[model samples]
Target chain A: MFFIGWLVIIKNQKGKSWIKLVESKEIIEIFFHGRGGQTAITASQLLAEMAYEKGFIDTIAIPIIGAERRGAPIMAFTKISEKKQIRTYDSVKEPDYMIIFDTSLLDIPRIKDTIKEGVIIIANSPIPIDTTDFPDNVKIYIVDATGICIKREFMHSSGPILNIPMLGAFGKVTGYYDLEIMEKVLKKEFGEKKVEKNMIVATDAYESVKEV
Target chain B: MSKARKDFTQEQETKIIKGNVSAAYAAKSARVQVIGAYPITPQTTVVEKLSEFVDSGSMPGTQYIKVESEHSAMASMVGASMTGTRTFTATSGQGLFYMNEMLHWATGTRLPIVTAIASRGPAPPWNIWADFTDVISQRDTGWMCSFCATHQEIYDEILMSYKVCEDYEILLPKFVAYGGFILSHTSKPVIIEDQEAVDNYLPPLPDEKGWPHIFMDPERPMMFGNLIMPSGFYSEFRLKIHDAHMKAKEKIKNAAKEFEKSFGRNYGNGLTQQYKMNDAEVGMLIYGDLALQMEEAVDLVREEGYKVGMVKLRYFRPFPVEDIINIAKSVKVLGVMDRATAFGSPTGGPVSSEVKTAIEGVEKTAKILPMIGGLGGREVTLEQQTEQLKILIKMNETGDAPGDLFHGTLWHGKLEVE
Candidate 1:
């Protein structure tokens, strides 16, 4: 009887997997806390562009946050899916992901306003995220992209443009996209040599990330 | 209707293209689908001309969105570009400063939208003069930044920026145009490439196919950016964006090259342009409209017994750190001039800061000096520059550097106190 029940469970799992391949679609709202020059908006654009190219027509909206200079913290949003038109212009009321470009922003009070239950937070720093005020359901991920860039011989040690590797890790966790599509999107978005190096970095990041 | 015959056989050819206006015309000619902007000096003509075209039905299926502010202008284009439309906007000086918040957003989203800027001096009493500070300040915004020196180049590069930006190899949008006071006021002839020619140059717009399509799904809904435990998430994505821009630099260069090869005219910046620099011991580094003055000064200095060169910085946003370092290695004394000042600092200009950063470890006898000149439209004469160069060359020889503040309008006379 136990064997028979086990076989039934396996059959159900297979059916669900097949159904997910055909019927699954989503509208995810991501909130990013970054300053001017950071890749908060570009992150969403890459996702939207890739989704659009893959026949998943999505819409993205980023509210103008502040008239601040470089290194000043700002906020932006994105929405993606494969359904009807997305017309709502509201800021992400409850973001599913809260990505902070600068970990130094933790020193600023009320930086946690973007956090919510089940919200995943990603930061571009070597230090672990300071989530003392965050909810128990909130998860945090941190990597020092500035360090990665320097190691890879990119530009001024100035920290910006870390979305490529983070997206790779994000894709691996969610299983939302295959590496092939992401690489293609990166190539289309960035170009060849960069795409090649970044793809290696991204794939390595994906491999390095430990699923929580 | 009967028309009286007039002398229609006059072969006429003279279409003035102001830098900003030319950029707008180029964008329109490139079949931009949406124009989002707010009026600002120097850059106001860009949208005004675009409005005229849309109003006159010269361009169809193009939405001319008038926003309340520069911030909204950028935000609107961010939305419009997501819809797979070619989007553009323009601003100048404080307007670009105001849109600073959205600049990163536009680039972060990797939207290949193009923007024309009429660079002007920034705030504190609000002066409208051509300066690189506004554009130089946002060099970290992740946009493919390029400057146009002439009105014709503005038209060509505006189109070129879009072409390079929208290339599948380079998805980030770009900022291109000269200063308003210089290029906007100075009218010159520009070759308006036929629409057919432009269409042939740029790739067809993004289409729905095997590429990821954007849509709203309700039933099988999933989250876009959901909470993921950092078993490692943050560092990875940031690298992706950085990688894209670094990769895009070469792609942009290649696209510009290809555009030149196709059109038989290369208005795009060939990496960094060096004028009479190969044999020069002293060089002046300048950007935007001020570079023209530097070039003229170099010419005048060359006539004398001075081996002087001028480096015109076109792509300022990427900072071009490596290239600047390489150039700094050769020149004995590098005099960096900017029309903008960073209050209370050794390096009063952004260009100086980049040069200093790039040459941190260079083992050379080169001396770099940053000078703030021509702010608020104060004249920067060749004589004044020559005098400055004499001092810089002497400083390089004797190792006796001048004080941080070289020249400025004195608000106070020599105080009559002991």
Candidate 2:
């Protein structure tokens, strides 16, 4: 009877194999929470472009548009798929990954609630964060992206451009992309003059990012 | 007006680009000679990209006119078209609404000028998200309207738009619209075809003689849009425009066939494309970006032992009536989804109302479920779409409609009010 029950379980799993494959090969949806002018929205687009350049079959970067101010909260979503086309254009509700460009965004209830079980987070912070409030299934990684940007002198008129470093840390943790792919896409997007400096900060963040 | 054709041996390149940029690339590839520009959200980047191309001398000899308003943009396109050049421009939402006056002027003059529209919701509170009402509202403007579901289709359809619109037998302005931000802002890999192959496919730019009817030549200047008496061919001109639109249905199909032969890409009859509909008992008719996602929903629902299919309505003005009738006959129940509002119209949604009219006199047809969602860029997730499919199946099985049917239409995804 135990063997028959085991067989039944296996049969059910077999019947639902397509769902499993879909989940496995599913588009990786990543949510970004940041302050305006921190470049989180651009990060979302850069990540998609980099993933596509790295040979992912499809990618879409969506920015949630609203009234904008210099330091107001902003949100964006990037989805990258390996084989199947990413069709739905909805904002990611249950993201596989999250990038917090400003760790203070975690204090906002709406941003905090976006955190769910089984999500890997790569946050830009100079110090470790208190993850006790998060579910146990969630993993947290941190990189001093802002510090790296300062160190590498990657800044615009407002402040440090955080997208490259955040993307760098993301690449290091998830292995979705790498420094090489980063250089290639950045050079193409930002042109040759800025690529070297951008890669400097990106490389620093990639090497220094660590689990919290 | 035949010129020496360029070589066609160069390979096509695929680039990860936004839908707006894809439209710009299509205009560049089609070698559009005149570009009228006005900045609007989502659509601004399209003209920006073109201006850059022109500034860099990549599009040599092309004239870029920076217009102050969308009205002037369309007016400039009409003026340029009268001068015998391939003309193109793009606009969205309020910009499209502003151009309403000139839209009639282009089609009335029978100029084959092509325009891309990044469709957005009309506003009282204001919105910049994906909605189709802005384009659908122009249905009576005598222009051929089509929607694209993917980035590559945005490029391919514009190329095909010029091919169909420029045909002497069907000289009509066409609007190739896609959902704002949903398509306009999203990035995807799209193949930019070889220019030589495109040139070979599209008709050569008209010579100085201009279109068959009108031209702006110093040697023999002609007048256009002059007043005509009520008894003097005014009614006849209107009838001819109607006649050309009816005839364009065939020209569009032939253009799609020839495009496929040259580019090796198929767009399912150029009117409507179907997915898994051969033995479907329940189906949905959708267009624009939503149609692509609906395919995924159909796939998921089919996995659960349900017979579901999807038909993507490509051309709106040429209203794929025969295709809708045929699909209606195949399904027990059909859901027509629209992302645009029709206010107090028969169905409260644009495409659904059209679907009802198309199947009105059919001998055997599915019961139509008029549905609306994703207005103003409301996120219609795949799960919601799966539920939508299940609702269709339930309606088929139980012979009952879904709840929240306002005036016999299901307004899905409404927020609860306390």
Give the candidate number with the greatest DockQ: 2
Q: Give the per-residue lDDT of model 1 (tens digit) for A141-190.
A: 76566666567654434563576666766666656565787888788766
The window of 10 residues in a row where model 1 chain A has the poorest summed lDDT is A1-10
- The runs of at least 3 residues in candidate 2 whose Cα sits more than 4 Å from the true structure, single-residue gaps closed, are A1-25, B1-11, B208-210
TM-score on 0 to 1 scale for chain A of candidate 1 = 0.76
TM-score of chain B of each: 0.85, 0.97
After superposing candidate 1 on the true structure, give the runs of residues whose Cα lies further than 4 Å from its correct spot: A1-212, B1-14, B210-232, B266-269, B343-346, B395-399, B402-418
Error of 2 at B261 (Å): 2.0
B1-418, model 1: which lDDT tens digit per residue?
A: 0011121111222243446667877877677888996998767878999998889777766789989999999988887876667888988888888888888877666678788888777777676766667776777787778887666667777777777777665578788857655566444345677665676786557553311332113443433334657776656655766777777668667867887886677633455678888998887777666665566556645655678887877776556676688678878888877666665554666667667887888787367776666665554544455455555666667776664344421111122346
Q: Which residue pairs clash within candidate 2?
A: none
| Candidate 1, RMSD to the unseen true structure | 28.9
Q: DockQ for model 2?
A: 0.39
